[model samples]
Target: MNTQMTYTAFLDEQCLASGPLVDVATAIQQHANQSNATVLIFNDQTGKQIDLDISGSKQDIQQRYAEHPETVKKVGRPKLGVISREITLQQRHWDWLDQQSSSASAVIRKLIDKELNDPNSESNKMLAKQATDRFMSAMLGNMPNYEEATRALYQGNKEVFLDLIRDYPKDIYQHILKLSAYAF
Candidate 1:
């Protein structure tokens, strides 16, 4: 079945409305749902779509961010900002790291790396398993240009992606469109 969703997503100066969506975030979400396959749309004033994880869970969202690390960390209500030096690491996180055979800093780094590595590892499992799973997702089962893809997604340039595939044969384009999880 297909999910139809439309919402008023307000970006710089206008509201874009699209429907039959699962949830309506802010006005930014309207443009996000523009393409039929876009499950998540992030309104970046920076003129880009941030890494995406449609799951909506905080951990999951963070994982998506990991697969695509934002070089320009802009502080705003938008994407639950990255953990900077100013932000204190959670105590429970520290405790979890202590229980495991790793360092808390390492854990955070892994989270970020995983987001940059595997946009699909948006969900977290048990602590240990989550780390390993993220690693594998970013490393193993990765595509020929997974890293490059991650960079493009981070850059949030759909135009570039469009240009890349613009010359593809009809068969290849159809094949790319066949993936249920893929966006434009």
Candidate 2:
């Protein structure tokens, strides 16, 4: 539920629109009204296709797709954007945490932040590869040399991947390159 998340829409292999959900929804609604072309919308962050109800007026579409701020009551410091969740730890782990000067939550947050900030971390690299793969699978699944291009992607052979997809549609080629920039 990331409110700031952006989306990209494609009509066949041609990119149609890309922006916030509301803007994209309106664009899709207008395009859909004018043509019977099939438009696929994707969550940019996860490279996953999403279905949106765009059968309405522009205002209706915008209202329906716009992000509404949540009003849920948080257990921790709401002003600081802290949320509380339950976690189970082993007795030995709890004992060790209890001996630390900082709270266990603070210690855990630091550890997570450290990992998140490390762009070269294995987990981050894997996530980048997975995202690139997902996008490629969706957009280039039927294209020529798809299998070889995918292999090159996972193998971290940027040159080979680029060469394999060199003849793809310009928009798709650029988008694939952008999405897979970190994969290698």
Give the number of the best model, judged by lDDT.
2
Candidate 1 structure quality by residue, lDDT tens digits, 1-184:
1212222222322223322222333222334455443332322111122333344554543454333446675754227544445446589866777886666666767866676445344321122223222322322234344344434433545566445444444433332232212232
How does each model score on lDDT? 0.37, 0.81
Question: Cα RMSDs of all predictions?
Answer: 16.4, 3.0
Model 2 lDDT tens row, 18-46: 88999999988888878999999888767
The TM-score obtained by model 1 is 0.24
The TM-score measured for candidate 2 stands at 0.83
Clashes of each: 19, 0
Residue pair clashes in candidate 2: none
